[model samples]
Target: MESFLVLAVLTSAARAQEVEWRHDYTFARREALDKNRPLIIDFTTENCFWCNKLETTTFRDSAVLSLLNDKFIPLKVSAQLNPQLTEALRIQSFPTLVLAAPDGKILSTLEGYLEAPKLAGHLQRTLTAVTNPDWMVRDVEEANKAITAGDQARAMGLLKSVLEDNQERPIQVQARHLLKDLEKQAADRLAQARQLEDKGQNAQALQALTKLLKTFPGTQAATEGGQLLTTLALKPEVKQEQRTRRAQELLTQARADYQNQQFLCCMDHCEVLAANYGDLPEGAEAAKLVEEIKSNPEWMRKACESLSERLALLYLCLAENLLKKGQPHEAALYLERVIQAFPSTPQAEVAQVRLSQIQGQPTQQTDFKKAAEKEEGPAVP
Candidate 1:
């Protein structure tokens, strides 16, 4: 009788390890919140072989099943059934796993297939993050205080510090949102200063820029404001003529570079001119040139076929150009090509970083050229 009882207990325990995924996301989210666990939403479509493979193989693993049962409130969301949720989350591929906090803020999104061990590892890491949400909450609180006090720099610093750390997905998302808000605030202030400068209110514009730099140091707006300040200091008529002449010179150079087949160099000149003088005729011409170069199939084919570091650099430039044009999907394809073709090169690492950023993954701010240089080590002959 005792031996029979032991066998029954073992069977029950084994059965208990099996994962039970909730079909309803609402219920799963409520349960996750009540249990203080992360919610794992597995997004799959009808025609995805990899999604089926993941369900059959990875999700069926004893360890993965156990982790899902014990640590997460798992929900299986069919793209067909949950079209709104899929669109809201921007689910682009099959077998995407989104780990979100109880309050419905996404913590991380893992795309594609993973073996049992890797999936288990990811679950464990997410569990750690879910269990330790206090640090992130504290950081957000402090950042809010800094912002309320009109200390933009301190707020930005605090938010960036949280982003730099390995925090939960919601924390990183919140940080990114706040950073974008801060950037917009800085931009608005810069715009106000520019308006003042354009109206020949140089002294007021200078004052505004000085205040803006103090509030939003280390931002793109501050850099632009600083450069604008120099131009503002000059007589308005002279500044206008100088700007026109400079824009023309840049456009001429960019055209020359493009004709000479220096695509990357041409892009640089055109981008600068377009950004700084987009209101001018020269600026419009520069922007047109950039578009022409970017859309050139022959130029792109040559860049892709080039040897060594140049190929990676060309790919990177193309990706950046596409991103600036608000075409992230197209940019990602080029980035993937760079990674696949030059896996061992420094450019590959930078490409990966940029790809992650485009995918809404947590990534640190990185300079592409600087990252490549660091990875390449000492210059080669």
Candidate 2:
């Protein structure tokens, strides 16, 4: 029984260390590039208890370890020993996990310790994104083809789908550009109604606006026309059209708020539209927009978070490069800036650790400030 128990312990230890982590980031990068796979950088420190917990617990989980071993070029980076590499990677905290494309563009980052299940999910998503690379070019080409075929509706639908699904900033900008062109085309189609309204042809303008709304339902021009109908309805002679116009105006405003990234404001407008104009065409669009916003509440937040991480990484990289050139003071200044500007972020934690190391202080002695106070407890074992 004693021999069996010792054998079991040895076997478990071997299983726990199953993930073949590359010690060198450069080698891992090279392997990832060659294989066209994502580079998974696991940033850790000698004194980080959480990092040990991650290795012993989450990383020991068979599913999590198997996925990392199979799908990713995993690199184990020591934050203490590899200061320059750590800074370059912008490892803000111990146990900061980064998933990057073969070209070293960071796809996603998870700070702090995650349980096996959550980490597995993140790994799966990253693997899917890396392996099944979805390019905006395909959607762009499809939209262009639809436009050439004179299928404006089909083209608009494709563009909208791009906006909804594509997270790449460049692709989003391109989609927006295409949408602007489509919006202009739509505006031209409704020019007659606007002209009639400008000429004080109230009945004719109303007729034209109604026709535009019917012909181009669920469009930007239709939305604008709906709002204008509300404005016209407010006139003493057009009071009879007031009821539906108010709802249309609310729905239009809700959509505008959503596009502007004012998510909370959009929700408020959507609620009003739903309560008052649920039966109207604009209301239907509003309902869809509300559902989309609710379903993907983190879309804008994730974008902002990704941008912040990139900016922090930029500063850290610059600082590291400067330090390598024998400019400790300048490096310290950049680290200080990171701590000051992005307190509570992973970058801030890294800065704190690095700064402490430079000052001959304890690595665990971090003067980190929280972005928001929360119930504090050990995040890992």
Candidate 3:
């Protein structure tokens, strides 16, 4: 009789529950990526009553089990154990459900207890949202259009977006092929620029590299070209020659604007020339032009009114660099200028945070980036 009861209990236990949940988040995340499916992450605490209730009840439902095992990768994580993941996801409550795309983008987050039907409904809706039967065809078609328009940057961006969104075999094959072709063209241009540089035709090489950078801003070739461009710009001979030529170009623009009585535009060119090539003869020329403008009270007033708005970005950039170099005092002076003079600009908003960091902290060792790091949200139970 005892043996018969044991056998019956074993049979009942075998038929009891069905959800195939992977406990390790890392393994499940890789599985989701490989399978090109979304993930359902269940966050729980060790002693949470609702989490236990969820494990025993809703997870046992056939519909939920089928959906999880069939359409989505289900991962169970302990909130107390995976603090990093919890903080990154910004979780703030127990029994939270995070539905994420294969690329790790959160599709939906649910906090508190969710019944079997509601959870299943949420999962089904998220699945429907991510299910795109035409993303492959649509993106490739748009990319081809961009390529035809001679916009290689747009084409590369579109192709990259496709590769990131979907990992299906067919889409992956086509997107990579197109991306490789675009990179090939960028590479050819980059090679031509290098040839010019090798021949000591520094000016022509700079022009070619600038064009390549503009045409393929995100490609590997453009990245190499950027390094080469910096190298060429750093050479004493190249630097001197380029600065002279560029300053002359700015002076020419300033002169043309002066002749047209566009004193504000003339001031803009003068400011750039004075800031960059201040020791060059063009700096004296720019100063002379500014002096000529100041003779006209109306022109000087118009320039003073317009120049601050344009210079706000430049000042903000300079302040950020100073902060990086542990010179917060200098950085703060510029930051204050942005806040006080160009308060309406987007740069002013950034400046306020950086300025506060300088005032709030005792040391000058902090950077704007560190000050800009947002505080974490409330803790998850």
Candidate 4:
């Protein structure tokens, strides 16, 4: 009966586990590339902590799970069983997401524990950069020429637009940082002008600052443009009003929240902005947020939680996601976090029982895992 009980528990555990939808190598190669999605290869080992955390927490997240399902042919390679494959992929980390082409060409790679939004952003950016036909990677020499020849405006314009549009793309992050530094030089020139003006050298100050404003309109340097124009009694062509500035400020705030893992607040602000815009770019962004929220309300809530709200519900969803995965040990860890963090909530009570079962206590069995694993691939659902 003890052996039978063990068998029953194992069966139940298997049933509860939500196997990532996956495809065989052949099918993955054909279908994934055809759809312009990368073949997502996850290199993992048994009993690895972050690996299991990803499987239980991140992968099980409905938003992340849906993106994986919709955007890639996911492959889970057990590094132990496939040493050759691991070595070939150069697996130095336990949970590395390899973005590969259908022909076994690795486009790029991301490693470590990524929260849902960031993971999704990285995935989308890598895929966009890799799969697109017209990506231009200019050499540093060419880029320098563009800058030195007074084409800095053109180069900066292109790079800045790309960075803004692809904020989650790793390449964009690097590009943006580089551009920001360059912009700072222009801003410094403007500041020097202000110092000259303070010293009563008005003519020299105006000359020095005017050079920067003319070169980079709508930039940090350009903030002084309006003031300088007013001083000269000249009306410059470009004008960003108070309302426009306020809108831009709000967008910046929303982007910051999105970056800081406050996705729900990001979504909320997006929605409000969208309503005002009447189906403009912000509206489309808000639509995307609505879709993401619908896909993973539980995980998003946890991710977007504020300091004031109780975390019991978020913990419950985490526990549930873990229960869906086969990692009881890791599931129990999060369940404890939930219990300890939000002990008063009813969700915590349910989490306590789930945690007990995860810690080897007996629980009712189910066939959901087998059914789930039987799905075609990560994109199966």
- State the lDDT of candidate 1 residue by residue for 4-97, as single tens digits: 9999999998677656789997788899888878889999999899999998899889899988888789999999989999999999999999
**Regions more than 4 Å wrong, model 4:** 1-125, 129-135, 138-143, 167-171, 232-381
Cα TM-score of candidate 4: 0.31
Please provide TM-scores, in order, for all candidate models, with all chains considered together: 0.46, 0.38, 0.41, 0.31
lDDT of 3 by residue, 181-220 (tens): 9899999999999999889999999999999999998989
Q: Candidate 3: where are CA atoms >4 Å away?
A: 1-132, 165-168, 264-281, 287-381
Of 3 and 4, the candidate ranking higher by TM-score: 3
Better of 1 and 3 by TM-score: 1
Please report, in order, the local distance difference test score of every candidate based on alpha carbons.
0.84, 0.79, 0.85, 0.66
Better of 2 and 4 by lDDT: 2
How far off is residue 172 in model 1, in Å?
A: 1.9
Q: How many residue-pair clashes does candidate 4 contain?
A: 6
Candidate 4 C-alpha lDDT tens digits along 1-381 = 999999999997764445455635557678775775667888888888998888878777667776677667788888888788889878988888787754566777888877878788877766675442234345333445667887766667666655655533434545666688678877887878778767866556656766776777668777775587456433231222323444556677777876776876776677777777534555566566656665886746665455324466666677678768876777788777876675444555677678666667764223223433565333345
Error of 3 at 107 (Å): 31
Q: lDDT by residue for model 2 over 293-346, one digit each (tens)?
A: 768849556545656777889999988999899998999999999888887788
Which structure is stronger by TM-score: 2 or 4?
2
Worst 10 residues of 2 by lDDT: 365-374
* Deviation (Å) of 102 in candidate 4: 18
